[model samples]
Target: MKKTISFITENFNKSSPDLVGGFQGFQRAINMEKEDIIQEIVLSGLKGRGGAKYPTGKKLMQSAEHHDKEKYIICNADEGEPGTFKDRELLLHDPYGVFEGMLIAAFAINASHGILYLREEYKYMIDDLKNALNHMRSLNLLGDRILKTELSFDISIFLGAGAYICGEETSLIESMEGKPGRPRIKPPYTLEKGLFSKPTLVNNVATFSTISAIIRNGYEEFIKYGTVESPGTKLISLCGNVNKPGAYEVPFGMTIREIIYDIGEGIRNGNSFKFAQIGGVSGPLVLPKHIDTPFSYEDLNEIGVPMGSGAIIVVDSDNDILDYLDAVQAFFKHESCGKCTPCREGNRQLLNILSRLREGKYSQEDTINIEKIAKTMKYASFCGLGQSAPAALLSAIEHCPQEIFKRRD
Candidate 1:
């Protein structure tokens, strides 16, 4: 079996007391220039775990530079992506670590408030997270003048109604403002205008957890885990047709074949691996030919795959690829917020085509139209959802064509 390279999750235990000493580096950073804190994080080479893979340090630096306003820090704990459950585990077992990361982020950007945009499905984790926050407050780790320093940062958990799009930063902000969950346009990106139209820094659940580890252990130790191009560890939720379906924290540079056979213990019930979707539905579709492809931001990006949310869903040979694509299209069609023309219309069109194809009634025109619509969505869609929905079908057309169409042109 392939082994795991656990770094952030090394001390995972549900009953352990909230970490008391890990806040030292963050505290020390407060006494120095805010730029110094941002520099330390930049050196760590941590990318956004929320699928965008944007440099965490660069995002923090931009937020840090905006010193005139009350910036906000957000932890996107909405684990809504299909096959992703690593964030839920983090909150249940390491609530303190999450808080520590939020605190560090708040202090780094000189923000006074922080929010954890938790999904409603994980509502059971609220009490544990709340209790951990209350405990940290009492210990002077949170709330006014943290650790007896000038920095006074506080954090709170905000529950989200069950909406997949709410996991998006702008949509989460919209939901927080009591509006329907939907993504906002860019140019004034979330880093500049987010959370009540203020400068906000949003990160995924695993992103914040990893932040605590970097602050505590120093970025050098964290950097040693992954490659230079995509340094540091990643928490991947590996499921579907795997003998072992669970989360594993591993370094980058491992092949998909290694992750499936070694870490996931191979396909379930002796079924052969057919393909895998890395980074959830919004991520890229992998084929048998690409099994040896390294699992890293650089490697995956080169193949036009977005390392979305770190979810690896394996599909075995026994499963129906046409039916699978239909379900995938249905998800995007249902979850689409309908604010934009492209995502709303595009996903619906894809679903209709998938349905026809599933019924063995597809044509040459359907095949040609599929790629054209996917390209349109990719280029003209307003947000990541619409832009990313075409990945699987597009990959299928180019890679696994026989699996998608009943009659070829």
Candidate 2:
């Protein structure tokens, strides 16, 4: 089998009927009742790629069913995870697909306005996206009375200052509304009350592009690639200690061992693989013992891991696990929004504890305290950032307790 099969990552550089007629189908889709589109999405089994892995169809149905006069559809281009860049790859090459996905979503949710919250770090790709948006508008795929239909939809671009926390859906919504990008409290989620108190559909860049592909290929063809629970290919930013460190789209249910040894071309510098952090910094570490676990949402969640951001960082026996964990802790510490005390204080405490442990200024009591804080943040925090911040750190410590406590000072 091929290492990377391009589905969502298909090249958009060429001309084709599907390419130009992107919104033409969307216009026809507008004629269908909102439930029709939502049901099709449910049938497709495409989950969000922004780490949450929630049912995209459920979100669309909720927002579509809401009786709101004003509704919104937002593309979260803010791929702010530390090693995540698959979204950047899409916005650069497949801008039309991204817009097309957003357009289809707007039709489903009856949204007149759409926004692409592009990440500030990926500002270099802005011109390409703007050009694509213009090309789309020229073809009547976006902006004002799309494809001779009464439905009028327009999209705008808003760049975001790079903040890892804002990658959370609610936090991204808050950032788009001119507030500091922080995760909002639940009970009124994004679909119910989002972006100026209106029904909204907020999905990341990869999710949007995948929607377009699923529409073009139909759900039957799309579902053939992945597991029943997580159908369709996933865009993974495969990096770290891998020999071939680049983005690749592979089907779900493939084992991590295959991804590392085969697709990744094995560990770099001829070193043996120690572990890999699936899904980004917040994802769980894939120990050598668990390397055979498949990359499916239900399977990983059953083992306390998540398909968060699809950013996998491979580590070898030669690398220091403690240092890697320390860096992970520091990232969460710096990126914490301070809206929730557990995330704000727990990350700081974790980082300090790790540093002090390395300096031989801490005891076993501090390790127990760290574990207690991690547990607190998971249940006590208001949002996902705080809840998941301790994951990789705790895992690394669990696997390498002596190394985590080794004196470096």
- As a TM-score, model 1 comes out at 0.95
Task: Tell me the spans in candidate 2 whose CA falls farther than 4 Å from its real position.
Answer: 15-34, 407-409
The local lDDT score (0 to 100) that residue 21 gets in candidate 1 is 53
Which pairs of residues have clashing backbones in candidate 2?
none
How many angstroms is residue 42 displaced in model 2 relative to the true structure, after the best TM-score fit? Answer: 0.8
* lDDT (C-alpha, whole model) for all candidates: 0.84, 0.81
Model 2: lDDT to the true structure: 0.81
What does the lDDT read for residue 228 in candidate 2?
81
* Candidate with best TM-score: 1
> Estimated TM-score per prediction?
0.95, 0.94
